[model samples]
Target: MAEIKTSVTINATQEKVWDVISDIDNEPKFWKGTKEVRNISKNGNQISREITIAFRDQKCLQDVTIVPKETIKAVFTEGVIVGEKILTLKDMENSCELEALWDVKLSGKMGMFTGIIKKHIKSGTEQALQAIKEEVEN
Candidate 1:
């Protein structure tokens, strides 16, 4: 598994940040790479959803698992490659920090090209964290 982790601190209270992060539907608004997210099923904090992520001209379908105020994990159940993303939030003295950790295992033709694509995924996750920071700070 290849892992990428990125974090950013927001000058907002944990609760304030959580309010935005916890709402899975609002992801596209903050994460530019995400084109859309539709909830497939939900039972309290546990949720299953389909996410459409647009990178350049490619739109990929991902199966996502969300645990409110805690973790959000998404995997490419179908698409060019198989991969997973994990986002977590933590409180830190008058501010909140959001961390994005991604572990991806490429399969099929994509697996043969995983080395070239890994950097893009890492950079994208970093950009997503930056967007989240800006949203929470502003």
Candidate 2:
């Protein structure tokens, strides 16, 4: 398992930041590689979506666990990869600090290239955080 942690400080209220981060529908706007989000199924607090990532012509279940205004954790509950994404928001009075912690653990042949996988994921995390910061601050 490879852990990747990234964070950005946005000049926005915690609630405002939370409003944007908690909405799965808002992801496509900020996530560059996320092409589309569809087939949303909500089971009480757990929510899952079939997402089209990039131009792969494929989709996977992105199961989410939310903690109201505090955190949003997502994982590939079923798909080619296995990992967890935990996004947390800290109220910094004047500004909010948003952090993302990602863990990737794949099986079979893909598992051998954990270093390459983690590098790509870390880049994505940085990009996503920067996008979120720009969206919230602007």
Candidate 3:
């Protein structure tokens, strides 16, 4: 499993930041590699999203646990990865800080590209956080 953590501070309220991050439907707008988020199934606090990522040829379904502004945790049920990802938010004066922690385990044929996947996650996290910051601050 590869454990990656990245964070970014945005010039926006915690509420505003949460509003953008928590919206699972609009995630592709700020997230890197994500192409589309659909076939959403919600059960109280748990949500399952079928996502099409740019790096993958097929779409994958992942279960996500949402706690409003506090945290969002996700685990993939299908695709190249079979692990969990977590995103947390913190209050910092007038601005808000968002942290993303990813714990990814490769599955099947994708396992061979672990090194490439790790690099993708490392760079993608940085780019994604920056994109999120820009989207929220705009």
Give the winner by TM-score: 3
- Please write out the lDDT profile of model 3 over residues 23-135, one tens digit for every residue: 87887877767888885778898888898877855687899899888898888899878788899999999997899998886788778777778888889888988988998
Candidate 2, 62-135: lDDT as tens digits? 88889998989889776555788899999997998999998866545767877776777788879999998988
> What would the TM-score be for candidate 3 when compared with the true structure?
0.92
**TM-score for each predicted model, relative to the true structure:** 0.81, 0.89, 0.92
Error of 1 at 115 (Å): 2.1
Model 3 lDDT on a 0 to 1 scale: 0.85
For model 2, name the residue pairs that clash.
none
Candidates by lDDT, descending order: 3, 2, 1
Which residue pairs in model 1 clash with each other? none
Tell me the whole-model lDDT of each prediction, alpha carbons only.
Answer: 0.74, 0.82, 0.85
lDDT of 1 by residue, 12-115 (tens): 98777778877778888777667888777776655666667664444455666777677787777766657788888888898878898878756676577777
Highest lDDT scorer? 3
| lDDT value, residue 25 of candidate 3 | 83
